[model samples]
Target: MNLKEIKLAPFIKLIFIIAIIAYVVLNTDIMGFVSKGISPVLTAFIIAYILDYVVRFFELKMKVPRSLSILISILLFLLILTTIGLFIVPRVVGAVSSLIKAIGNFEFDINALSQLDFDNFYLNEIQQAIVDTVTPLIQKLTNATGTAVLIVVNEVQKITSGLISLVISFAISIYMLGEKRDLLARIKRTLFAYLSDQTANQVLYASRMANKIFKAFFLGKLLDSTIIGVLAYLVFTIFNFEYALLIALIIGLTNMIPYFGPFIGAVPAAVITLIANPSSPIDVVWILICILAIQQLDSLVIGPFILGDSVGVSAFWIIVAVTVGGATFGIVGMFMGVPVLVLLKTLIEEDVEKRLAFQGYEGFQSNDIKNKKSRK
Candidate 1:
């Protein structure tokens, strides 16, 4: 190994790798080609990951055969999904239809605004101007909402267009689940072959911890959102709110996001309420209050029970993750950002602690460390 050869060889390899990446990224056709193949692969990975947790529970806790457990878990997942679809879809469709019709004929009753502040001339003028300006905008907004929903529904129905791809993904997931043990063993063996025992163990531990954090975030968020959604639906329906199903569905889904989720869901819902009941804008205020109450309950009670320290990151970092995620990858990015941040945070913390311990610089000592010091 000549000195020049050793140094230049690495640079040459790096340049080659960068060139290939640049070509792939810059060439739209090639990028699209790559993207077309990525969806199924991603979907399968997601399916396998979610099912792995269920399969493990059945195998370890119930002593079920792994194969049988996988089957049962998959079947149960499908059943729950189908049940939810059957229940929520029809009601959402009906609500959307009613909402569209109502909005199509929506009128901002200036008289109602006047009644709220009869003696205030400036307020009345502003109210009149708002009524004139906002009425048409409201019509356009509702019409657009209805059109967007219909387009999404159509796209969903057209999912059968990619049925073959979906089936392939499911098959891939099934194979992964079935061979998970062998797959994991092979991966560990390869890791050990490539690295020291300590390095390989650290890698495995980090991988497992990442998987655990992701599972906790995704599963807990899903359950928490579902509960919130159900509660929102119940409360809205009990209050006889128009478009209850639609609003609740929005609230439920948005609740998956961290701090801003409730407000994100509530604003549109309040708008819908006001538009649906222009005669009494008080409904909008009441709905806002209702959302506040629900959010309080979620933050104080439901969220803790379901999501308890899932990310283990503080609020500021979570917000940063969410913002960056949303900016980069849209909604899915926003949904996943926190868990990814959690994994990164965990890895960093582990590495820092290890380095600190190796240097014999422990400020905040653990119980074991304190005990050892006392013994010494």
Candidate 2:
């Protein structure tokens, strides 16, 4: 049968077959030759790669050359890195160290708490047992936390696999950016050469969807976190909450975890404040309430203003992504899980819409719909 005569289902099966073949090749020997050491160089270049589009934007539209644009990109990249290194890093390190010190003094903090009596407090036998079990652990938390962090750092050093993987990832991203266009065009031609034009376009469209998801996710995350952090710091400092800078920073960063990050970040911050001032439990509680209010504002108010309806992944998918990421990569996995879901969701949506329109559905111009509406 002629290529166009082949049934769509069989064609899809063939594409999956090709994808499996490609995956195996990438998994086996083909990927082995593409990477080496100097991961930091690769890291810088990945930073450069993201900025390259901006560079190219200025170059083509603003009447500049590639070299000058690249230079501008490089300078901006370094300035950003330097700014973070000099300004942000110190504060981060100090906050971490302070938290550790507080942990080291945990027993003292809790013991101080136990020196009080509660009026009209009622507890069942089960409640009393639970409290007894938890109290000692809470007492030991300060030491345990510092010790746990030390153990983790040691394990990271012991594991030779992580460092190697990190290096390879950076190297791949670097080379990919440097030769992106030539490689992209070659891949496009190769995919289109064998496959139907429609199938090739689907692959291209999926890739674009994935890229858009990544951009929306990462940029949105950075923006949301920054605003929350700045607001938290300003509010906390005004109220003179203990560990304001540290707690605000932590809350701001972790707030991006969605639904759960705020709680995770806030609990620790509140605990630290409680440890620092067990006498002022009421004050600590009030501060926590304030922090929660800030989070609510961020989620409902500022968040919508910035992010809009960009990522349309639902709540159920979010839970699934978090579960999978935490299962595989622990905290880091959990942190990135939602973004993965967002990308996958976008890709799925694009594919489904394409298939619907392929057989001819009215008003199914998914790509141009947004542009047209905006123009109108």
Model 1, residue 255: C-alpha shift (Å)? 0.8
For candidate 1, lDDT tens digit of each residue in 1-376? Answer: 2222222354357546864775555455876777687878878989898888899999999999998999999898789868867997878877777776776677776545545764778887887788777767766775675676677688779778677787888889999999988999999999999999998998899898988898999999989999999999899999999899899999999999988788789988987898788888899999999999999999999998887767676678889999977776678668978897787766665655665655665543554332211331
User: Can you write out model 2's per-residue Cα lDDT over 1-376, one digit (the tens) per residue?
Assistant: 2324324565467646865764564466654554334444556455655776667777899988766776676677668778976987778767767766767665433344444455435634545555677687676774587676787578658668765664565455555555667888999999999999998998898788767776677677778998999899899889888778788888987887767788888888877787666667777787788888998998789987777766565567778888776665567677778877776555555555666656565355556543311331
Residue 51 miss distance in model 2 (angstroms):
2.5
Sliding window of 10 residues with minimal summed lDDT for model 1: 367-376
Q: Residue 252 deviation, candidate 2, in Å?
A: 2.5
Q: Candidate 1 — which pairs collide?
A: none
Report clash pairs, candidate 2: 103-142
Taking all chains together, the TM-score of candidate 1 against the true structure is: 0.79
The per-residue C-alpha lDDT of model 2 at residue 373 equals 15
